[model samples]
Target: MGRTRTFDVNEALEAALGVFWRKGYEGASYADLVVATGVERPALYSAFGNKETLFLRALERYASNYANYVPAAIERSTARDVAEGVLFGAVELSTRFSDRTGCLGVNGALAGSDEAEQARAALIAWRADGEAALRRRFERARSEGDLPANSDCATLAAYVLAVAHGIAVQAKAGFAVDTLMAVARQALEGWPRSGNTLVAEQRL
Candidate 1:
């Protein structure tokens, strides 16, 4: 058998998570991982396989610790509350920390090398899952009369997530919480209501 490990695995992973969160998958280097985790490359490899694997692990950690608010937001009673909850939760999380200002899922792999395609695809799927969750909730709301039957729940879900992602990008670009909140409000005002508003919008 091999020798026992000296470092805290979870601690190292959290540190690596921070590196990946702040820098992104293609941007984060092995040197960054080593410096952040205080672990040598060999040890890191032993613990988490390779950089891609480590990034995937960090994504899991990010979802559990940080992105958990997405589900909570979906639990709101009203469709407007759910949309607002998601946007509010997104901005709060994106700007909560001074050091890491963007979401790990969004920042992890927006666009990168062909070498990291798997990691990039993972991020896409992760984001798609979130959008799918929102779509389902919105569809239920439509069925319950919270939304107009022709509201195009999937489009509504996509719009909410698009705004959420835009705010995250703005947060990374140094936008303030109040500013993003204003943006969220502006987005909400455009939400579908009665009298043939966005109610007329539908899918192809």
Candidate 2:
């Protein structure tokens, strides 16, 4: 019979996620993972396969936990609301935590090499999924007259996602939540006015 695992999987994964978020894929070594997770090397291998696999799993865990605000924000009243919630929510999410500030997805995008290509690919796919969802939401908003007929939903989606990415990058660079929110507010000011009413009328 196989030996039973000892540590709490979710708890350990959360720890691993923090390490990956702080260090990135290539920067996070096996020693780092083992120390952060409080698991022995052999046990870590048995539970998560390899460093790359562990990083992927940790990245998924981070996404499931912290990266969910985007989807929730997109479900708000208007396309402008979606953008506002997304940007402001990004500020809160990126800076709310002290140790793990910034976005794991954005942080992971830059680090890693050929060996970590799968992890990189996973981050890319995740971003693409977010952009796709945003596009669909904006397209629906345009159809509902929440946005002007000439508004490009794809560009709008890309623009918001890009801004969110910028927020993440800025957060990683030690910007405070208020500073990031200031940036968000400025971005919202540029939100397209539909029906001569600013979409960012609602306060953050």
Candidate 3:
């Protein structure tokens, strides 16, 4: 039988993910991955196929690991609460891993070249999935009478999604968590209410 692999694959992948998260797809070179993962070029290729494949894995890992707050927020709260939680959660996530800095999905790549196009598409799709989830949650809220009967669930979802992405952008730009949270609160101030305003009574 072939010799058993010595390195921990999950650990190596996490390290490789860090490199990709810090540097976008085009910027993260093979040499960079090697240094980050502590696995040589041959092993990296054998384990993960190629750079694009590795980046795609890293992107997926980032989504499952760090980008899960949107759904969690939607599940545990009111429609207004969902927006508040997502915006604040974005700030918390983007700033938590100081070295990584910004969200992997939102800041994973600059404008894509032909080679980086697939990676860019993967990130966009991940973001889009979150938006879709929020939309569904808002639609449910509207159906259940948590929101106004005439509330545009699609527009509200898009609005919250935009605010979350904006939080990521600001966090990547070095905005403080307090500053970002303040921004989140301000966004809630304009959140469309049912018969009465929820923003006035809510602490968020």
- Tens digits of per-residue lDDT for model 2 on 70-152? 88898898888899989988898888888888888888757566888888898899899999999999999888878888999
TM-score of each model, in listed order:
0.93, 0.93, 0.92
Off by over 4 Å in 3: 196-204
Give stretches of model 2 more than 4 Å off.
196-204
- Name the top TM-score candidate: 2
Ranking by TM-score: 2, 1, 3
Weakest ten-residue segment in model 1 by summed lDDT: 195-204
Model 1 misplaced stretches (Cα beyond 4 Å): 194-204
Candidate 3 lDDT tens digits, 1-204: 876677888898899888887887888899999999999898888889899999998877777787788777988657888888888888899899888877778777758789888998888888778888888998887887678889988888888878878888888888988998898899998777765435435644
Clashing pairs in 3: none
Comparing 2 with 3 on TM-score, the higher-scoring candidate is 2
lDDT of candidate model 2 versus the reference: 0.86
lDDT of 1 by residue, 88-189 (tens): 989999999899997888888889889989999999999999999999998988887778788898899999999999999999999989999999999999
Cα displacement (Å) at residue 105, model 1: 1.5
> Distance from true position, residue 16, model 3, in Å?
1.3
What are the lDDT figures for the candidates, one per model? Answer: 0.90, 0.86, 0.83
